[model samples]
Target: MNIKSVNKLHYLIALIAVFTSIEANAQEEIITVKKDSIIPKKEESKKSEEDRNVMLNAANNTGPREVNIGLPASVGGIMIQENGMPVVHAFWPELPTRTWRQSVSLAKPGLTKLSEVAITQGELGFAVSSETKLGSDTPSYVGNISSSSFGWIKGDVNASGKIAKNLYYTAGIYANYDPQSINFKFTNWADRTQIYRAGLTKKFENGKGKISILYKYSKSASITSHALFRYKLDGKVEEIDGFKIGRDNYMLPNGRFKYLDIKSGEYKWMDAGGRDNESFAHTVDIIGDYKLKNDWNLNYLVRGRYSESVSFNIFPTGMTQATPESGFTVKETGEVYTGSANSMILSYTPRTPLKTFMARAEIKKKTDKHQWRFGLTESLYSVDNFTNNRSFYYQAAEADPRQLVRQGAATGNTDADGFYNYNVGGEHHNGFDNKLAVFGSDTWEISDKFSLSYGLNLRWEKLKGDHYLTPRTPGFTLADGERTKFDHDWFHIGGSISGVYKITPSFGALADFQYTENNGLLTSYSGNVTPNLPKTRSPLMGLGLYYNHPNVSVVTQFSYLTRNNYLTRLNLVNPTNSSQNQVETVYYDIETTGITADIIAKPFKGFQLHYLITYQTPVYKNYNFNAFGNSYTYNNNSVEGISKVLMEIDPSYTYKDFKFWASFRYFSKQYANLTNVLFFAPRWETFGGVNYKINDHFDIGATVVNFLNQRGVRGSISGAELITDPAPYNDRLMVGTFIRPFTVEASINFRF
Candidate 1:
């Protein structure tokens, strides 16, 4: 056998042996591995059942299942798709599951409070979904999961009790931290997102009603993208390339560096700034519930939130490709920006700060034969933001951008006056966009077998917001020819009507016909033309059939989605002057449809298996826009970032506290960019693990991930707009991200 193979085999065998020996020793004691008892029973049966069901679903770690943070199962190894974003038009099984955080509807404020009761009565838990966890030092075990480098996850804790007669109190906290990955294989960034949040909720009831107050704080260090940089031997390289984009190409001076040195080595790569994303958000909320005579209940909520991206003068990282065609010159073998961060920021944001307020009220009536819910919601959103960006010119024509880093390297870019060369060519607009919205919904349980919910929403954009402007660049005055006032008024309507039908406990079907049209500043730029405003309009529908039995579970679903009047922003090289960039706006209409099938089975004792697969077709129906003194049209093309087929398989077994499992994740080959220049090969990863229950109070486990260390290229895809529009309008590229190499991690748990 090859030396490498033999070495791997030895480690694998050693791991398995160590785990088996420990478990065997614990087995001698004859102790059962079960959840610790945490209840002092009263009417606890229902609560216990709910907890068990949630735990079971969590263990599966598949679609619609929420990850519980407090459990050892949450740390790492979460099977995440699209890096860390919600699936577009997903399909689910017949059983009701919380696929994603349900929309926080102000009308159902009380329901949120009631759910917390379960937390207090049970164990503390946080759903670490949509975010990466962290790295580990040991081989993995059966339940340990890996985390994603980017995503929004919620961490929370709750407690409830009776402070006095007819007086009850409840408290909770919700916090989350976005997982930030140190450069993998190289200094190239693929995923770099930072988020910190802490929220406090207090609820205390009196004779009049139940009242709750909430306050939250949020901070974001930055949001950056890993660019697909061109690899060459020389250039005015601003940063040393440590790794290759979307591949396991080791770029450091030495051999492959593991996560071990990452914590200490991460800062060294900061010289090349990715897109800087710094922002803050503050929120305050008040909600209350009151019970009326008979069987009626009412709920009301008032909330206000303020948020803004920190204004900056530098992009730090290049806004686009650093290829020669983009004006950037590097003399080293690494990544550089073709475009300056300053120019990009000018085109992205024209506003300073943003604010929002929401108020809502809901009422419900329940009887033996019928249950009805009705509610209304109103909100206001506004933004006032702008930007200033300049360029730093290089004076040393003798310097090479591609030169690798030198310990004592001295930059020779100082001008005669010891001042830096600063060039100005960016956009600037001073304006405010305010939007008002009102919505209402009704939910009716018509019968035991069928139920449905419907809602309507209205939005008025730029109703009464102030407008102003400055020159696109500093030191330049705007003539009467340049339009600066960006103000307009428009209205939109949206709503949804969805229903469920159940034939039996084991058989059911679901159908949802939903459409939404809204207007707002969900963007960095607030420069809307008075006569031409951008709005978001999306319509989606889905149908599913499921059959559930004691031994086997099966589900099939089909869904269709369309995005029209979607907002598309672009940064373009100014045709009037190649030295600068021109920000452009375009709109496109898109359509997509897909089907998913899943099966979970327990063919025999001590064994379980799950299989899921999906097939999809996403395409751009039409794309026409005018920018840089030219109008262009793109023919129908398969939208980038969407794969035709994907699947996952999980199998596990347990025998008297000794457990083992294997999970497989796979995706078909796909186009990394819309134009299809960058191709992404099909990729898959496998993880094998074993867990040993070392006598009830303590346990240890080990896991081997990507044991084969398949160096497959994989990453998120984007359209040409991410760069300059129409340059390669039909193209797409996979940024810096790849399947990790074969690795092993181990962990232990203690219960008191």
Candidate 2:
């Protein structure tokens, strides 16, 4: 072997010797204790101390906080960005990508409510699994109802009991409505959300085995929120002259919106917000667990789902103007111009139906010193045809912007129908996608204070579909008549190595490393241009330390991560020429180094404090690309839409039958664009709440969000792509999104 290779091997061996035990084995032992421990002990072990802190966090989850549900808000000191829509990524643009959806979302609704959540692997990015806990031998019923000052209401009820000899059943229903505090008019559907869900499960015993079937139905209306606020050159985000950041939005308050149907070529008005983009789904799961001879076990599951048409509708803010141009005319009145306006894009994706099926099987064997597991998984999904629509219009740049039309010929950009046709075209065709994976893992208990674990996964994925073959830019003359067919398949391998060591009963260390790969989804084909299908390589490494004491506990971790072959499509504006723009496809890489520390302390009875801080630098590398026949470079720039520092402190106190708690979260400034010249300043979000238990079966609570009443802006700059220098646009207005306003929520819980 070469000298460098030998040195690397020696370095790895040294690391393994330093951190001897594997985190995977440590996790397995911890979970076993949580499930099998029958007696409560007064003294705390290192594991018990960690568990206690977890329980404390769960018990204190009473306050109002930002709830995006299925959308990516923040994670690992960064916010996930949605730069393009590809079917293989997420059914919904804002949701987690396909590989992450199963872990991040409870799309099946009842799955989470009826199971015990668990993480079986040291690296969460590798896998997250849950164990179903329905149909307990004992009969039980639970229910809760909540109402908030902002016209939000939510309720759920669940019941489980034995129905027959060796048979049990569970049933539950949940419903909720959110008024969206940041937007105007609670009565309107703009930015509103409503959900209804019901589920039933049956479990029965067979010879030497147990089987369960679960069925769930869910219906939901979730709206997209995008608004306009001013971004200054000095890194200050300010509300427009007549607009309020939290109380105003670009959407119409009456739940009315108009757009031309691409297929019909006729204007139609639909309720704004999620009303025009509702979804319904039905799912069934069959699960089985069998005990085998020789210390072996077998587990299998089959899941099927059918979903009704689901759509996406949003009015994303665009270019802004201090005053309307001369020919600007009100669409409703057909009169002349005058007011300042913000150019807006009305983008719509019509509903498409879907069907999916998944099956998995796993076998496990246990020995005196080792545990081994092998698994196979197969998943298939089919989607119907869909189209993408893009229409443009001007709106008064105020609190509640009103649509305006520029006077032009019917054959020109702006039509007599009152809007400019940016591009309305077919995006996706009916197609099927499939994935198959085989995995294996082993954990070895090496000694009293050390363990080792390793795992490997091989996955085969295929995307078969056709896309509309039309250029997507404005002024393109070709119609959407041609189609591009794609049948692409990829094979990827991933592996993880982790070790944990206990220095003392109350102190421990951990080390982990993982490598994975990803490719574009079927929907990526919709870009008209042939999408890049290169495998994106991602590698992560982490080192951590934990300390535990009766009154205090701390956990700190240092992580380094790198990912290459990131594919994105950007609409770029020339920095040297404001009027010149182009749409380009680019590939880049990102490297992130970070540190996170979590500390919990209970100095006295009934009072506790928990603090968490994360500092990360996620920056672009080798970000050179060509657009409009010109080469550009953006190396060493900060990744857009992510803050470098995040911190939260939560404190709670209990006295008699009342408990009071509060949380404060801080985020550092974040870059607004890829070029990194514009940014939004740091901001804080605060929440506090109190709960009172009136009786064994009754409890009431109230929470206040944004208690400090700080108004701030966040997320990316709406349409300022590739604007390296902000000087020329200083005089012109710019738009972005803002945080929600102060709000309050209350709830009541009951048990029997």
Candidate 3:
């Protein structure tokens, strides 16, 4: 064998040896792996008959089962798709998923969170039904409440039981007060959230059919903040000299903001400190399953949701030198000429009311050697109305920044509140979209040691929208313009093929290949006048191996993916002239290759370690674009906002009824600007928690986030998209988001 092949074989042998040794040493003792409700593995057959019955009962009551397309799983974002559609649309404003129970697999490991939910080409588009536990046959109740050091309180309560023969029900409520709902600091904004949900299940007398109905109501109000920072010469995003990373922001002291109401043609006040952005949503779901003759079964689901939300935000634009010649006067206190820099403040608010409906039906048949499924899915998403408003003013760049009134003629004379009559009104549109797909898959058990699975999905989609084309001028009104219509439709196909081979009972190897194509939805077209958006094509290939032992388990995977026709919007500014700027829409492509290793080990009694490492190279390709008639080409630049290396190490110990765990996550440097000019330094996030079981009915726990006190700046830097050189920005401050500061939370839980 070649040297490289020999090296790989040696490594594999070493891994097996390590795990085998652990298994042999622990054979005298019993080791129980954590039960993951998501994965349905072959080992489940080893469970007891009563356990099997419970599992079957849970499935019969929880509506349709989740759809697995032989893909690798990931975390975060809309990893869970319901009926071939995302439960929450990625392009729209939505609330957090604290109360949402679901899981996700993105066809491959080590994919970025953005790529996980982008709904682009090559994705499996797997369906994971959001089934509530309300219809459980066993009676259970759980409640917990927690308060954070950051002055936030959160609590939840849930109950499930059997009400009558073949009848089950579940109910729950959740609430949070002044929580740090967003990535911004809790001290920067005020927020609240509440959710109420209930479900009922019924079974047929013949035991062959079942149905469940679920309802949910949720309401939330939150604020997102923008913070200013400076870029160091070494390409590090640093907090301003006196500004704190997480404890300080640019919001008004009392959280009050004044802006123009475009529809009413008058100025209005917004309470940024309290419920600045609000959302209300209602959802209803119906699900059914029936067993048919000849070993065939049918499962179906239907869901409808009505939601309305409004978001208001204020952020800073470009910065300029602060001087008397700049003609700056503080509007709030009538002071003049201060600070080393200044920037224009912009306000944006959008109100969206929408309705969505989805349906799916699948028929499955199981034979001695083959299992087959055929399914159909339909989704209808409509935006009843969408309206956005905007306003602009200027502000001094300093802690507790003050609004400035321009006394110079260069910038138009300002009103008493320092308001400028610039782009004060915003666009409006109404959208309607439909998607239909027919899919089929089969799993062939070729032998006890080998199996193959393949699936295909044929899809047809239509997007229709009516937009008001009027410019966002001062005093703009919805009735002042005529609406224009745009309609587009297309057909697409996607499929996946995978196979697994068992080298031994405890060792296995697998490979998967997938390809898919996608296009822009209503949200992508709403901001532009043209209906034609670029289509994207993505293809992914992966190879993996897994080894399981009595005390240790390891999974390693390698993936290569190439996706073209990425879409993004950039706000570009002239390097020599700060006043010369424009917003441009750009299209680019990316090629990524990654490897991941996940390991779980239990070296001794009541002690476990979970470790994961991912290394990836995601680079730009054909990234040529024009801004303000200037052509720029960035062929092999690293993709911005994504780290190349990520690692997670978690260790836990359980003694008696008490448990302790600590987790450490590390991230490599991440580029902040599209031009690859500035970047954020590598950082670490530490979390540790301890829990005590105070009996079968009560438990208490405490956890801390960012326990290492790493006040690092993360995420993309706003207003720096066009900066190719950082020399000019050394003295000027730019705005960027930051990681949460250190905070601790304690909670008590009870169950009956």
Best by TM-score: 3
**lDDT minimum window of 10 residues, candidate 3:** 18-27
**Candidate 3, 1-752: lDDT as tens digits:** 11122122222221111100010000011111111221211101122211100111100111121111111111221233433345554324442232232211111111111111122222433223334554667888878787878666767888888999999887888776754423342234355667787888899999999898888787766555556677775656666677776666565554555666655656677665554466778888788899998889998889988887666556455676656676778776777765644444444454467788888787888788877877887778888666555555666676676667776656445677766654433545678888888877777879988877677777888989888666545556666667888888978777766667888887878676666767766645544345336566767677788877778777787777776666554545566555444545566777777777767788999888877677777778888877656788888888777777877688888899988888777778888777788888888767788989999999999987778876676656666767776777664577765656787779898988
Give the Cα error of residue 717 in candidate 1, in Å. 7.3
| Candidate 1 residue lDDT tens string, 148-247 | 3222233433334454444443333333332233233323332222222222223434454656555545443322323334311121112224433323
User: What would the TM-score be for candidate 2 when compared with the true structure?
Assistant: 0.81
Candidate 1 ranges with C-alpha deviation above 4 Å? 1-209, 223-278, 311-352, 388-453, 458-483, 486-491, 500-509, 520-531, 534-536, 572-582, 626-631, 652-663, 685-752
Off by over 4 Å in 3: 1-85, 95-129, 181-189, 235-242, 258-268, 274-276, 340-347, 409-414, 421-425, 468-482, 579-581
Q: In lDDT terms, how accurate is model 2? A: 0.55
lDDT of 2 at 337: 62
Q: Which should have the higher TM-score, number 1 or number 3?
A: 3
Query: How close is every model to the real structure, measured as TM-score?
Result: 0.59, 0.81, 0.83
Candidate 1 has a TM-score of 0.59
- Model 1's alpha-carbon lDDT is 0.38
